[model samples]
Target chain A: MEEVERLQHYFQVLSDVNRLRIIKFIDKEKRSVSEIVKNSSMSQPLVSHHLKVLKNSHLVETQREGPFVFYQLTNPKILDILGLFEEMLPKENLVSDFSPMFCCPSWWGNSN
Target chain B: MEEVERLQHYFQVLSDVNRLRIIKFIDKEKRSVSEIVKNSSMSQPLVSHHLKVLKNSHLVETQREGPFVFYQLTNPKILDILGLFEEMLPKENLVSDFSPMFCCPSWWGNSN
Candidate 1:
């Protein structure tokens, strides 16, 4: 049943577009909640909810500097997982300008 | 919205314990409904329903041989996806004997 729990946790994490976007942001660079809100369309409360779930599932880890909490992905391989999933999507389903991104690899190189 | 539908689909497919099992069985080899039911703990109706969803999402494909139809994974790359996820499972979460079954490589190698 651990497999069920582990998988259910992961699937639940991946199922939410906000959570996936949060991971993409953290994967790009360690970020505080404010930095995350600045780059992402999600508001403070939605980011908080997704971050809590990602942290509980161990997919993400956090660092604290006095009053600030910075979050980063716990595993780099998760990038590979997300990349593979992106490959599965047809090119047409993605927006032409790639605004309102579902996911992309350039976040790491394009920023920070 | 298309990305939402697509991710919702694949996450929904991978999330269910029974649906993952069906993919495992078919991924091992193309199987008839009876072969699936025989290898899986799910009942006839349940298997039928999961198959419908998987088929709808194109994660699975089926072929007919006279009165019997056989199902198989639509893409082998899905194997790499599942395998990567398996790598993330902690060593202890798995039952030592591996009795209940899960997404495993040997389902293809050990059988048929």
Candidate 2:
């Protein structure tokens, strides 16, 4: 693909709220599909679908540990892009920064 | 719109190649529609359409000087975002940085 086309595809893949949320959830550390679904409050199928798109775009990658699959960002530079976007946004539009969680969503009472 | 939705829309607006081209053209200084059309080699209507979308998204702001309208980026931080993206891109996929030109494309040997 041409340089412009690849960038257009990358931006298109990033043009989703759910995908951004999922990306943020998995930024600092790898997470299982269930963990992403739980943190994002998105359905398992939907989370998986977004993960597939992210992986296809080379924005994300995965590893297998036993029966579990872990997904992580392919490049840490993605976080830098996200940070720039956040900086451009209005303060009111800002969300709290992602804090990686090892425990279940219910156990934390929705701090994410 | 919600924060996520607004961000999604922002990214969606940025997902187009022409829009990115136009944004880069107007990054440092304001340029008239005719100027953009000349540099982009895009039709007048297409350039106008992309400019309208960018204006609507608050990505580009317009100022009228007599009969001609000039567009400039709303924030300079956008360049930082573009810089980060360029850094993340493969070396072969990268394009030369924009050098603002006051003359017609033919006046120079397509150095841009």
Candidate 3:
């Protein structure tokens, strides 16, 4: 897919918190749909719908184990997506300064 | 903004190709709304609407140069967002193989 299309798809999948949590969980380890429901505190059908969206975007993939289906982050490129946000957005860090580097030209110059 | 919120807003702005083109142009250098309209093959009102969306998302900012409003990429972090998609997405490169590195475990290990 084109970069814009992929970006749109990534953002569309991320528009929902439920879907974001699903990807985060899957990133930790592959899990079945029911497990996602337990962790996300959302309905099974809702989880299934969100998974379908993720799958369609190619952000995730599924594997069937007997009667259960397991979902995993098939695309490692999502790390770049998450890392992009991590690098751009501000975060709260207890032990250190959590300010974003992009705010300063010096940081940008050094990093680049 | 929070990463999820930022992601949603970025995606929402990017969902329209008109807005995407606006950002891409601004990324190259600051340009007036009229210049954007000329380059993008879009109408003035349409470009205005799209610029409003981009401004709201904090992806692009504007400066009033006399009678003209010049837009520029204020947030360098958008580079990370764009980089995320570029890394994840498939691109065509005529000179060499443009295959994504994410497809292989070795690439991930090496890059990470």
lDDT tens readout by residue for model 1, B1-112: 6554556446755777788778767775889988899898889988888887776566777888998889888786777677777786333432222133454585677431
Best by DockQ: 2
The DockQ figures for the candidates are: 0.13, 0.18, 0.15
Q: Could you tell me which 10 consecutive residues in candidate 3 chain B have the lowest summed lDDT?
A: B92-101
Alpha carbon lDDT of each predicted model? 0.69, 0.75, 0.65
Q: Flag the better candidate by lDDT, 1 or 2.
A: 2
What's the residue-level lDDT of A19 in candidate 1? 75
Looking at candidate 1 chain B, the ten consecutive residues that score lowest on lDDT are B91-100
Q: CA shift at A16, candidate 3, in angstroms?
A: 2.6
Give the worst 10-residue stretch by lDDT in candidate 2 chain A.
A92-101
Q: What is the lDDT of residue A81 in candidate 1?
A: 74
Runs of candidate 1 with Cα error greater than 4 angstroms are: A2-5, A88-112, B1-5, B89-112
Would you list the clashing residue pairs of candidate 2? Answer: none
Alpha-carbon TM-score of each model against the true structure: 0.73, 0.73, 0.71
Rank the models by lDDT, top first: 2, 1, 3
What's the i-RMS of each model? Answer: 8.0, 9.4, 9.5
